[model samples]
Target: MLLLSACGGSSGNAGGSGGSSDDVLSLALENTLPGWDWRKQISAGHVGLEWRPVYDTLLRTRTDGTVVPNAAEKYSYNEDKTVLTLKMRAGMKFTDGAPVDARAAKFSLEGFRDGGGADSLRLAGVKVHVVDDLTLTLTLPAPNPALISYLGGSCGQLVSPASLDSPTLATKPIGSGPYVLNTRATVTGSKFVFNRNPDYWNPDDFPYDKVEFLVMADETAQLNALSTGQIDGAEISLGSIERAKSTGLRVDSFPNVWSGLFFLDRAGTKIPALGDVRVRKAINMVFDRSAIAEGIWNGNGVANSQTYGPISPAFQKDLVDHYPYDIKAAQRLMKEAGYADGFSITLPEVDHYNDEYSAIAVQQLAKLNIRAEVVSVPRQESISRILGGEFPMFVYKMPVNPEAEQVSNVLGPKGAFNPYHSEDPELNKLLAKWTVADGDQAAKVYQEINRFLVEKAWFAPFGNPDLPWAFNGSTTISGTLGTTPPLYAFK
Candidate 1:
């Protein structure tokens, strides 16, 4: 899951040709580029939008969430599925003229694994070997079924080996991608400019000759830019849907993220109530998901209890209402858990997200006799604070990735969202089985995992919220499996 942050910046008319020009594509991003280091890159949310055009991954994920070949022509796994060998496409070179060969792939992969990035754990206990100039193999300690899919995301983005040790690597990017960063025209926090790579290996993939990202942290500014023909498209809040449509802009909405409260301290190291399954289930049943979704999201989201979206293989329609809104039942559970008097807990909030969710949570949880305190934290420090185990539970949003990736992010023993490192023996067993399972067996295991999480009340997921994007009709933008559409997906 990407820890989103908000920062104020001025939106300018830099490279804003609107959607009238077919050669240039302009869009507004909620956040500026965090950095250019692909190793520390996040492949969801607005951050992914900033660096996607400048780096090419070994594999690619289609709009339908299928993994396919990109820089690598083909890939195969060993009989035991512990080793993955990739064959690189011939003649591909980075913008700096370094050959994008097996050695470069090895360096990039190893660097990412040891870089301590957010997604580094995906490659933990993995070793890379260069077989030749065009062939490389990744040896894994155990079979990871999601490894291929991860390669299509940030974890697989390849950087030039020549620039690996460059001091300016964080601020500047050097890769074999569709576009090159126009450093002269880019204003660090305001706007970013990219020009087509003349020597790009796959020129036909990207139709636009130039791509520009204007930093518009405020949604109102993004809407104004879209209405004034200053930008082609922008990811907007659900509340702006009607306003955007009234202005004659095309609105594209899809389920991309699930937002709700994360019960991080299941072990109850700080709050003993969270350790009891009954207390967690009682908390889950107290909130009306339908009311929250319609009232807060303006009827733009679906009310579901599971973290997996409709498209995920693990998504079970029957689990949508696993815990219905029943105040009496919740109180009964709370009383049964010997917490009839309730307990106090603090929830951290960020400015970028709507405060209404947490406010409603506090109100609903109060009915169940739980005193929830909402604490506002700085956007920059919110993620660190949560991961540091400062809060037992908190309201947040996260992208709905594939089943395997979702498990690795939220349910795994070392999951990013599992800040307290809470462990369940049964969940650990299912996760181990999922790593080596394939085909029908894999789907079954995934569903079992989802059922286990929901039944155990590990989280109180409100629903899968629609990610809305407003744009002009000059060019078409396709929906992606991420918060924002990729630049190459626009035509």
Candidate 2:
């Protein structure tokens, strides 16, 4: 299974709306909403799909990833790009009658920054200030072009200042978006119902009068729902592509995520063999990415050696398959690293990932005399076990976001994925250059970093898997880079 990180929630019946198909836009999500708390919600995967309709972001991104104004009509940056100013649309009010002003914007931004959301780190060291009723400013510690992109996502979602401190905020949302959550009709973990906001400033933008999301974890059930007209759209796996196409549903396929092994023990504190660059390169050469992409992803993806995806500015065409499958070459490297007799390593078996990939990887490593052990852990405990340094390596899937966001989340010294906090002076220097550079200079620096990561064998990337979304004839959805498009994109 191609697993995206999601929070587990209770399961319940998917109650029907009993309304005409034209009036109600129904969709199936692979998981339920973690909660209504904007501060706790993840900005990617299915979670964003759930709550975005009820919240208006300060900025929105086009399908091509360009930042455009949404709730905030205008925005600007300082000369050094360290200060961002936002001008909110006048007379906007939340569902509960609270004005969506600069104070509310500052409150929401500060709440998210301090609330420990999955993407909260994006707002770290940033300060929000209210310039006036219609304007606000964000002061950054350093120049970060990616901050605008983050605003286009959950980090930019605004909440009512009146409800921000309410205990019921976790279950009820108060925002100025085009939709209002129908809590009476919603069943926790099963179905979510939304009613059209009569007072919304941009009513024509959202065509549906009523929106419903059914949580269907199983792909087969999702396919059944789509075919039977129970839902208008859903995200399906690669294996279900043919079945979905046969049913006349439009299958939108695009490369959005990358899956493979994350080598977290580059410093070799826990796993000595993994510390050596030669052994890491040897491990990268052992896997035939072409076969894995075809076999595991059903030929829906292309073999990739670098972490950067095609949509990213840092993506280099020549770096797609930097390492070819060559057992002899891998053996030579192992010998050079003084690991001719492979060592033992333990990998975490999280519920989110399909064990088949790990099994195949273990079998392949056995050829080099490496003894690998898999320890099964619950999904809730997986992050703590993996990031807490309990496991040196693990197979996982991650989003291919913009170059700067990717660097901060995965490659930077204090990145969330960098558990051991491994620091490379050369990599740090490149990061500083990329942060201050812009236009062609920024792209060049990012590409250089991508090449450096591949040459160093920072990760054993399998490939970029194609994400397929099936929509009925009545619904039209556009694809976005790195993530599923926001709920408003559905028409």
Clashing pairs in 1: none
Q: For residues 222-285, could you state the per-residue lDDT of candidate 1 as single tens digits? A: 8888888888888877888899999999998878678887898898888999999999999889
Query: Which regions of candidate 1 deviate over 4 angstroms?
Result: 1-19, 352-354, 377-388
Q: Model 1 reaches what TM-score against the true structure? A: 0.92
Tens digits of per-residue lDDT for model 2 on 1-491? 01111122222223335323666788887667668888876565677778888988888765565677878888888888889999998989999999999999998899888988667778888999988999999999887767887887778888998776678887889988878999999999899999888887777667777889898777788888887788888877777788899988889886867888889989999889998989988888888899988887888988999877787888899999788899999999999999999999887775434454788879878777788888887644555466567778778777776556667767766665686888788898888898788778988998999898899998888888887889866677666445566676676
Model 2, total clashes? 0
Candidate no. 2 TM-score: 0.89
CA lDDT of 247 in candidate 1? 93
Q: What clash pairs does model 2 have?
A: none
TM-score of each: 0.92, 0.89
